[model samples]
Target: MEKQSIEQLQKICTQLRRDVLRMVHAVQSGHPGAPLGCAEFFVSLYFDILRHDPNFNMDGKDEDLFFLSNGHLSAGWYSVLARSGYFPVEELKTFRKINSRLQGHPATEEGLPGIRVASGSLGQGLSVALGAAQAKKLNGDDKLVYILLGDGELQEGQVWEAAMYAAHYGVDNLIATIDYNGQQIDGPTEKVMDLKNLKAKWEAFGWEVNEIKDGNNLEAVLEGLKKAKSLSGKGKPVMNLLYTEMGYGVDFMVGTHKWHGSPPSDEQLADALGQLEETLGDY
Candidate 1:
């Protein structure tokens, strides 16, 4: 894909938000909150940071690799992948439907052009992304590996184990970002399990840490990503704590955990759609 201006990237982000809302509403199923929350991050990664091939290589021999740890937010990843030219935008209509390649969570059995592994089980993506980074090093690929994880998902012990491995082994080419929306499917993440001092925890684990105060803002996300890239190859992994509202664009859903996995009703969908402009003309 060609390089896009910041204005163009923002436009694509709007379209992606629209796509997430509609896809979840169409199926009356699928998680929408994190996807809506991380729209700008997805837009930033695909359009600006990632050095990937839209042509779809399973091995990704010489390209930057991305892993979606919080796979419930597959809607945003799917929309971005489509918009980034991995697959036809029209394929989004098949999301969550029987026999559709776009499953509720990303899977590889169906041979989706852009997906490399199945995900949805939390606390596994970071390890997988680290493994990919190791493979790249083994092959002398000289590229980065990126992963997206959720704050709530961090309650799983496996996440910390992966953190230890990354730091211990000096996985310098790996970058991970967390969607710190403070909300999860059941309720607030704090109520579920407190992750206080998240930044300090990562720092203690021997990784570089950065923060994005407004993940919904395109400029902020781009700036954070650029900084993360600069921090790479320094003998330590990097993490970006991206603070975001659970449902950013929609008024009623913002900052609440209720929208975490709930599909909006027809009336509610209309209301949400009103908040976003039809940028890129929608998928």
Candidate 2:
């Protein structure tokens, strides 16, 4: 594949970040921090990196997969999926509403085309991705699996179990990214539960690790994702310690643990939107 220009992808990342904030503010509920923090990486993967159709049918036959472990951040995922044409952009308005496909957490059980598993509880996605990776190999398929987790989710024992299993069995087709934004629902991850030496921990687990200087910077994320792609198929699973601001772009939301899972008030929403451009047009 030809390399994508970082400048162009930066514009797209800006739009995706706008979409994430708009969706969350519209619903008056959901997690914005992870989405805001990881927007560039999501844009890098969906628009500029991953190989898959937006109209993906989760048969696990030929498509690459994205698993969202921090399911509360579904607003951003849904926005990106819609903007990327996975489903109609109109669906974004239904987020977190009863009977809406765009639920508070992603679930394939609802026949959502792009999502492969339900992941609101956290920490299970990497294990699920590992299973899919092994299955893909068994089927002679070379498609890759990508999973994103919050830094807090790493505290789950299941994540380490999946980590051990992937390294032991050589699940080289999987790329796991941790949203190292520091803040969680209660407070900063350090205050809530210290995950000291996070990168070193992944390296110790036998995974190849890379760090993105700024997760919110589209150029940097695109470059890091390209590097991650190059490292694929090298007989080691990859983990990225994505360093990002907890709530990026909007000044009121950035660097705060309070916005992790809370909704913006009507006044706050207006204030937040005042700081962003409605690049792709709001849903």
- Candidate No. with top lDDT: 1
Itemize residue pairs with steric clashes in candidate 2: none
Over 166-254, each residue of candidate 2 has an lDDT whose tens digit, in order, gives 88998899988898899888999899999999888988999999898788888788788778877889989999888999889889889
How do all models score by TM-score?
A: 0.98, 0.95
Going through the candidates in order, what is the number of backbone clashes in each? 0, 0
Query: Model 1: how far is 271 from its true place, Å?
Result: 0.9
List candidate 1 segments past 4 Å from native: none
Worst 10 residues of 2 by lDDT: 1-10
- Give the CA lDDT, 0 to 100, for residue 236 in model 2: 90
> Candidate 1 on 113-212: residue-level lDDT in tens?
8898899998899999999999999999999999999999999999999999999999999999999999987899888888999999999999999898
Q: In model 1, where is the ten-residue run with the lowest total lDDT?
A: 184-193
